[model samples]
Target: MKNIFIINGHQKYPFSEGKLNSSLIEKAEKFFNNKGFSVKKTTMEDNYDINEEIEKFKWADVVFFQTPLNWMGVSWSFKKYIDEVFSMGMMGEMSDGDGRSKEAPKKNYGLGGKLNGKYMMSVTANAPKEAFNNPNETFFNGISEDDLLKPMHLNFKWFGFETMPTFMAYDVMKNPEIESDFKRFEEHLTTNFK
Candidate 1:
């Protein structure tokens, strides 16, 4: 059976209640459980043990992240989680982790990845999808997803995770379309993991 880890990267703000990501996490848990996969979850709103999180990453076959786009970046809570957890010497556990040492040159920077067979996928809620495709829009150079998610892609790659196709919701604040978005999310999960 596949082991799956899901992270709800939502943070409560004055205007945003973080309900969308909460619902998504619930849906994912139910879906993965019904599929007979071994599922693990982390809700960013809760207090987490850093070592446990690292262990979860090591144990899972795949990791799924559901996040909201805040000012073109992940929420501060989620970012802090990453910064703290990854900084706890997890990268050293990846491969040799001493690529900069004299024994291993910096040229082999990406060779030290422990979770080589693992995979990751992210679903982010942001502005309308049309804004990304419009050439006249200067917000993201017509590649909003890539523009916003490149850092995450590279970080996951450095950790030896093959990336799955990303899923996104557009115009969340103005018009949520929650039901349709959930349907597409289900489709995405089924299609990618099946």
Candidate 2:
């Protein structure tokens, strides 16, 4: 909780310029800074070194992801970043070769993480809140946001990181509630971190 690493996983498109995600990242940065925590950040649109990112993961006590849910998953650029960085990290930097050995190949599948930090994801989505956690909902059919984001959670789990509850600003495109979302975001940070 003392040192935090934030990843902004926003990829800009013609229709979506990533303003909301950027704003959320800014708010998180300010919150952590004011609380006297050391903060490091990365944006997918910017150039980064794989080794440096691994070092940041080692240094951080918590890793926060600020992303927009695009087509039910993270943006393509962020996915590429994950592939590159995590792939390089597999060389004992972040993990130790899938946490398995010749003695027991199937015993420990994903326990090769070198870092033991925590992770949280803050997401923006075009879908409404009601679309989730309601059995009547046609699309999700009672599936929660966390359920939708299980893959991303597993990614962090592979690195031995614990998961914090996720935050989501739903219906951002069709029903923008910028102010309310900002308020809730701040409250979430306070409730979780403070």
Candidate 3:
């Protein structure tokens, strides 16, 4: 990717100070820069202009999202951001807006993505990775961790961006192996981009 856009989706709250996400963002910025990719980033804490955020998407070849799972889903701020930004009609104009004519409301429901070939990758930090592996687990019954991000993948696909395999850091709050996780994440960036 020649130009990459990174969104740090962690919300600053009383429970978390957003340190891990910030560190990951810093590492990613430096790593990509060293490899000569033009990188741009924004944190949820920033004062963003709607137009500029859209412009960034237009300029990027790939987008990387960093987030923490709040209540098993993305934070409220990130969801709000998506709602506001994507509603501006970045997902192309179908013949009938959502590719559905009034006569056939169910025909082409979700095929209006504008950026056809651009890609996205998500890196999430959350509870223990093993929590979702057991058959008796409430979160996921032996499903891969990537499944937790299915909604996000579909959302990005709606905008026409191809999805990349996600990177994750588990047990972040309880007992994060920061050093090991960073190594693995660095390796992921290297292998995926190369």
Compared with the true structure, what per-residue lDDT tens digits does model 1 show for residues 62-126?
88888888888788998999888766634565444634567646577755567854555455565
- Order of models, best TM-score first: 2, 1, 3
RMSD of each: 1.9, 0.8, 2.3
- Candidate 1, residue 185: Cα displacement in angstroms equals 0.8
Which candidate number would show the highest TM-score if scored against the true structure? 2
Mark the 10 consecutive residues where model 1 has the least summed lDDT: 89-98
What is the Å distance of residue 63 in model 2 from its true position?
0.4
What pairs collide in candidate 2?
Answer: none
Better of 1 and 2 by lDDT: 2
Residue-by-residue lDDT tens digits, candidate 3, 1-194: 78999999889999799888889889888988999999888778878877788878877888888888887778889888887776765444311245566778888776666675455555555567777767777667777676777888877777678877688888888788999989998998888888
Which scores greater on lDDT, model 2 or model 3?
A: 2
Stretches off by above 4 angstroms in model 2 are none
Ranking by lDDT: 2, 1, 3
Error of 3 at 20 (Å): 0.6
Deviation from truth (RMSD, Å), model 2: 0.8
Measured with C-alpha atoms, the lDDT of residue 148 in candidate 3 is: 71
